[model samples]
Target: MTNTMWMRGVEWLAASAADPRACKWEWDHGEGIALLEAGRFWDVLSVPERLGLLTLDLLWRPALPVPGPTLVDLAAGRVGFFLPPDPDGGWVGAGLRYATRGSWVAVPPPYRPARSLEWLVPPDGTGTLHSPGTLEDALRQANGTLAVLAAPPRGPRES
Candidate 1:
């Protein structure tokens, strides 16, 4: 199997942090409807993925330590995970770094667009972000990426 850029970085995380993608995700989770080739995805997950649900649980961190700047599908009844760039250059984290641009990224809960800062409300408020692993996994399970998952979260948090 071919190794994606991450695999090489996985071998040497300290060096990969300088990679530009790390910078992008460090600030923003991601956009929407992104495509993830298998090679890269596996590198981020640290598992062959053929391992199935076991891999899924680890990525979701159901029992493990979770990281920052994650992305997920918030569409009701169809939530899923996606691996954002490690935000740490893949040097010291446990989650995978998925390759994406400005798709598959839903505005986080209570997310407020720069222009709509005054109108922010529940789901529109930009806080309580999710794990990108869940976002990616949900899409793959959905059997399609073109299908954008729910609109971005609007407004502030309930708590």
Candidate 2:
């Protein structure tokens, strides 16, 4: 995704922070996903100390060596975590780089947008953001990518 797309997500996050209805969360494993309930995101997600750290790092980390960004589905009540793209990317929950890739890192809590100082143009401008419409769509895309990641390396086949 381009900076503009990331910025749009950031804008949404900022707007959602104050809106009580705008509740979305992510945690370490399937158990965490199972434990979540509507209107209970803050309480459920904040319970585990480790998960709290992980969430903070994922959302705020500078460069997520991963090919794609971690996804949060507020409307669907799902959070999909992508393991870093490579080993040197850092441990999933141990430590994360919080300032490498983009401008999304500086977003502060309770997750409000930073006020604009001026209009800054990104190197790549005005491109369509590759966002999936629903939770199912996001899951499908994520799973497909995960499969490729999990596959054993192979040499190219002869034509």
Tens digits of per-residue lDDT, candidate 2, 123-156, equal 1222211122232243345445555777999999
Q: Give model 1's TM-score versus the native structure.
A: 0.21
What value of lDDT does candidate 2 attain over all alpha carbons?
Answer: 0.29
Per-residue lDDT of model 1, residues 26-77, tens digit only: 3246441113332222223222233223334444546634432222332221
Model 1: lowest-lDDT 10 consecutive positions? 116-125
Error of 2 at 152 (Å): 1.3
Model 2 Cα shift for residue 35 (angstroms): 8.8
- Candidate 1 CA-lDDT value: 0.32
All candidates' TM-scores? 0.21, 0.21
